[model samples]
Target chain A: MNPSARQPVRATTSINGMIITVASGKGGTGKTMVAASLALSLAAAYPQQPPLYLDCDVEAPNAHLFLHPTLAEQQEVGLLIPAVDEAKCTHCGKCAEICQYHAIAVLGKKTLVFPQLCHGCGSCTALCPEGAITEVLDRMGIVERGSAAAGIAFARGVLDVGEPMAVPVIRQLKKWALPRPGQVVIRDAPPGTSCPVVETIRGSDYLLLVTEPTPFGLHDLRLAAQVAKELNIPTGVIVNRENGTYPEIDAFCEADHLPILLRIPFERAIAEGVARGKTLVDIHPEYGDRFRQMFLQIYETISHS
Target chain B: MKILLTATSPSIDSNVDPRYGRGAYFIVVDPDTMEWQAHPNPGIGASGGAGSLAAQFASNQQASSVVSGDFGPNAYNALQAAGIAMYLFGSSATVKEAIENFKAGLLESVGAPTGPGHHQH
Candidate 1:
């Protein structure tokens, strides 16, 4: 099986707006590469309705480097944190008792709030007995929207340095980059199966998981597959650096009934190209047609299910 | 003067807990009378801001001094704001021994935070 053997297929069926999210449980498994190239391919296949590419890895977003989108709009994302009014305050300790994160602490006459630990649930402000607490906008990150090659619609969220939470930023990016009718949405998710990853893959039509052939990769892939199972989402695997040595990934996928959608072998030229900030389709033009075929197969599976 | 000490258990014979934020027990004692009351630390299993919660608990007990191995930034700041002095004690010392050392001026007074907050990597 030659993955590069191009078989051109006609684009006859309309997708009617489907969200496809590319993710991996382990870091540095080529998630951004696969996602960016797929979006570009889809954009080329349907010039009338370009695909929307969203970079949901707010903590360390790098898809913009590959897409090179000329950002035309930027907006600040924030969360509502609590602010205490000392003048109208009574140190009743109710806010401290109610907080589950321990973000707020009340002592004799002092009320202290730790902004970093806050989840922005607005529980402290709403439950304050003396009406001393008010909600304040705490800036967490920013969202940028632009256009990339082949007129691919691009958007990304960048979280502030040292910020612990990325869910709000990802949520804001999704809202800002909502897809139109008959358009496909491609999301580049962050590595790992944590809250941020779950936030990115939620409400998606299909999940494409990328993994390498290694023990570390296999360990995290199982965890990621569990998350997809719990979410009840249709999922497929893309094995990067396929060196025929690690058959455990194949065994796991076979037992789990997950199809191997694509396999990108370990090649020095491919690594060098990607290292120079080149997409897979840029180095090998044949990949553009292959990705289109992959999308059509995914659409077929989704339509039947 | 009343003093707070981080301990492993509710007894004076228990060894001192090195961690101030996630310590097991907080014992308030008066060296002069040797009278003390032990309270389980409420911040033992807190997900975040454990230091601040522990400092608030210490202030509520009206402790003038806190004896622990290390004080995180949040606990140090909160204790300073409440006019409480911080003292460093050996991790192997018993709660009773720490109290004796505090009276004998053997424990070292901390000028700044002894630890970066646990939330930081």
Candidate 2:
């Protein structure tokens, strides 16, 4: 199966500035490439207003490769897991019954709490009938902050492997950035329509969905679009590596009334440059103007709508 | 002495189930009177803590020992805490044969859990 295709777009009827999140429902679809390039171009176009670029793909954050930001600030992000007080825990199995994730188990004098399976929703702790369960801080990831090229403020969360959760890290990373008027926050979201994706795109003003021209791309793009529709987030599609061969994506977008924002043609040079950790706009300076124009068009559509 | 055996089928002729918590059936037997009863493993479809729940069921059955192909960490710990001895039964062996072997003192006692519950929900 191809792990590709996903993007999120953003449009605001009330405001011009937006927290545009770029996502692909699947992985390895160049969400990072588009986010880094767009953020850099927007930063270059407006020097007075540096966009806040947040890499919310904490599980396997790769935006740092293209942005090359020297993270100056680092902070640990944690989740509160349930800690049972055996004295009060009468083994009624209430916590286990309430836990939808099966992170807790009460087995006759032995109470087992698997923190890795915990979602940190605090359901077990809050719903405890005996008040035996209490939430405890458990570190799961780290949030780093710095600045990249074109004076763009950068922040990304890195979740420790095998942590089984990324929402907490993404939430903490987003908390670090306080949105200001005229501040365009470009959040780089993780792939898939999972909890992490929902967490990354939550509270965002706009979504910039980056997709490809393959069948896998169209399929995941539809799923991502449905999510945005449900969340009432206005979205636009960016078709990467567009060679004009696949008409399926175009047809789908037209049928759904979704505008095709920017089409970056597939080029070997672009791929080679990205291999060495360079963004498209950075490698080919001419694309900077095109990306800036694309950014303006996004805001224009929002204003018009 | 009463004993609990994990089986793939209700009959003692059925092969022993490799999985402890998610096993298809559990047979409770009183060796002194050869009194036997077959019950479906309730934890078989459990999302998580199937092992723990299965151990709790075994404790409720008041079985002195449990025989299975393998035991997960949680299941093993719960069984140990419940003071129930566990024995490893060969995968190819049937429930009746495993119990007979146990009577002959041929069953190997499980000292600890075989591995983590990677297959658990």
Off by over 4 Å in 1: A1-13
What tens-digit string does per-residue lDDT give for candidate 1 at B11-117?
98899999899999999998899999999999998878889889889888989999999998888888887788999996337999999989989999999999777
Chain A: TM-score in each model:
0.95, 0.89
Instruction: Judge candidate 2 at residue A39 and give its lDDT.
Output: 87
lDDT of 2 by residue, B1-121 (tens): 7999998999888888888988999999887677799999987777666777788788778888999988987788778877899998863378888888888888889998888765421
User: Against the unseen true structure, what C-alpha lDDT does each candidate score?
Assistant: 0.89, 0.82
Off by over 4 Å in 2: A1-15, A85-92, A121-133, B1-89, B93-121
DockQ of the two-chain complex in candidate 2:
0.35
Worst 10 residues of 1 chain A by lDDT: A1-10
Among the numbered candidates, top lDDT falls to 1
Score residue A66 of candidate 1 by CA lDDT: 89
**Which digits, one per residue and each the tens of the lDDT, describe model 1 over residues A1-305?**
12221233344444557789999999999999999989888877778888999999999999987899999999999889999998887988889888887788786688888787788899999899899999999999999998998989999999999777899999999898888766789999999998899999999989999999999989999999999999988999999999999999999999999899999999999999999999999999999998988998887667666
